[model samples]
Target: MFQVALTGLLTGLALIIAVGAQNAFLLRQGIRGEQVLPIVLTCLLSDVVAITAGVFGLGIVLERWPSVLPVAQVLGGVYLIAFGVHAAMRAWRPGTLDAGDGTAMTTGRAIMLTLALTWLNPHFYLDAVLMLGTVANSFGADRWWFLAGTLVASVLWFFGLGFGARLLRGIFARPTAWRVLDSGIAVVMGTLGVGLLAH
Candidate 1:
């Protein structure tokens, strides 16, 4: 059990460390100090749902659904790539700062968008559901330990990201900082999309 817990913890944390669309958006909101908590909470909760689904046998089901998986991957990848390109373009030609005051990034729609961006991604499902599920199932009755570890990692990661990015709030006050961030997000999204397509 101890070993299983440790393994699950390490795997979960390592996977979350990747700079995906979800993480990028979280950082964006964090820098603006807008809707950070709700966004983070939604992210963590969605992970909980995904991981729990995995532990309870959703992974096996997903693995069998070959057609669905590829479709999801393509759709999610296209959306991410498009969104990234738009963000990059916006960064290159940013409008006035006052426009940000009424930006949609702080609304419920933004929260839902981020949640969908994370949860709807097939890569996320593959990692949290299929991969983690396979690991938990390996332990049989001890799968509970793996689930607990994963849950802990999810909670820790969301809080850390949500709060840690806050440290850069002042730096983000400058318009150029947002541009840099958008460009970085564009790169990460495009790379991930291409990688998914190749796979």
Candidate 2:
């Protein structure tokens, strides 16, 4: 059980730590100090629900439906590419990272955007549902242990990302820092997008 849990924990971290729309949005919110708690909670809860669904049985359905994964891949790749371009543009004209510098987004608006970002992306389904589920189910009776590990990973990552960003406040105070960060985001997104399409 411990070994299975460790596998799940590591796998979950590997998947979740990648560059994606959800993580990008979370980072932005964390840096801007805008609705951090709600956004983090939304992401964490969404992951939990998706991962649970996958581990229990949804993964089998996804695997059986051969066509669904490809379609999702195409859509996800396109969306990721577009998002990468947008991030590149932001990097080109980087902005200050002060709390007041960000657009005034209400908690409601933030939650709505969070939902859209989390659910609308096909990659979310691929990772949280198909991939994670299939992997978890492979553990047989110990799958629940794996699920628990993944749950821990999700909690740690969301909280770490949302709160840990505060530590970077000093570095992100400058426009150059924002540029570097956004540029890195752009590269990661674009590369991942291309990888998805290629696969």
Clashing residue pairs in candidate 2 (N, C-alpha, C atoms within 3 angstroms): none
Clashing pairs in 1: none
Give the best candidate by TM-score: 1
Residues 67-168 of candidate 2 have per-residue lDDT tens digits of: 887876787677778778987998887653344544587888888878866775677888899889999988999999999999999999999999888787
What's each prediction's TM-score? 0.90, 0.82
- Runs of candidate 2 with Cα error greater than 4 angstroms are 95-103, 120-122, 197-199
Model 1 vs. true fold: TM: 0.90
Worst 10 residues of 1 by lDDT: 95-104
Q: Return the lDDT, model 2, position 54.
A: 96
Total clashes, candidate 2? Answer: 0
